[model samples]
Target: MSQAEASQLLGLAGKYRPYPEYKGAGVEWVGDVPEHWRVGRLGSFGYFIAGCGFPHEDQGRQDEIYPFYKVSDTNHVGNEKYLSKADNYVSKDIASKLGARICSAGDYVSQGRGCVAWKQEANSYSGNSDNKCDTHG
Candidate 1:
């Protein structure tokens, strides 16, 4: 939509005002949102949990393969068309120590820091391998 039309639709030029000087690329309105929309912080919208690094001692032992996910895995899922395989795998014990964050089908995972700009998508573990559940949404 045109800038003027969007502004009118959003009530940005009535009692509300727009900044003539642009500081960034997004549309910034100077008034509250419609009654239906609520404002809140990221913490209020959803829980933020940090991912932990598996210790070197827990690297690989060939006991029970556990899915080990990283930021690159997320990128692999994109454009690959088919299900992407995890490059790393750990033991069940290590996965257990990592605990609750080990991830499961339908869990949302994020790469934590460097790849924060990517969109989050819910993932499902449908592969036969038990070590394929570390997906981020």
Candidate 2:
């Protein structure tokens, strides 16, 4: 369809036109969304959790490699670089005290303020550590 035709169908002409038998809260106007679409809060759609911080100096490196991810790692493409080497690992005791949440593949990670972007992918570490998501929860 032509741009003008599409705009007319979408009610972008800037004039208000009422639709048939529509009265709802939180909806300022009709044609803003599809008839079947429903609006809800983010909490209703999914859970929001924050992550925790780990002391940079205390973390150690040893056997058994794992991928460490940070908020900066997520961007337009996703977390392509390893934030930290697996050899530099944290102890289970420290991880537990901090209350870190473990994430698997296909899990979504988002930044709270600075970058304001979300990325989804499988994490390399199956074990737990005090990460960003811990703070949110």
Best by TM-score: 2
Candidate 1: what lDDT? 0.44
In the range 51-131, model 2's lDDT, one tens digit per residue, is: 556456644544312333444343325334312223234445544564545444444444442111112234432122322
Q: Give per-model CA RMSD.
A: 11.0, 9.5
Candidate 1 has a TM-score of 0.44
Best model number under lDDT? 1
Q: For model 2, what is the C-alpha lDDT against the true structure?
A: 0.40
Clash pairs (backbone) in predicted model 1: 67-131, 109-136, 109-137, 121-137
- Per-candidate local distance difference test: 0.44, 0.40
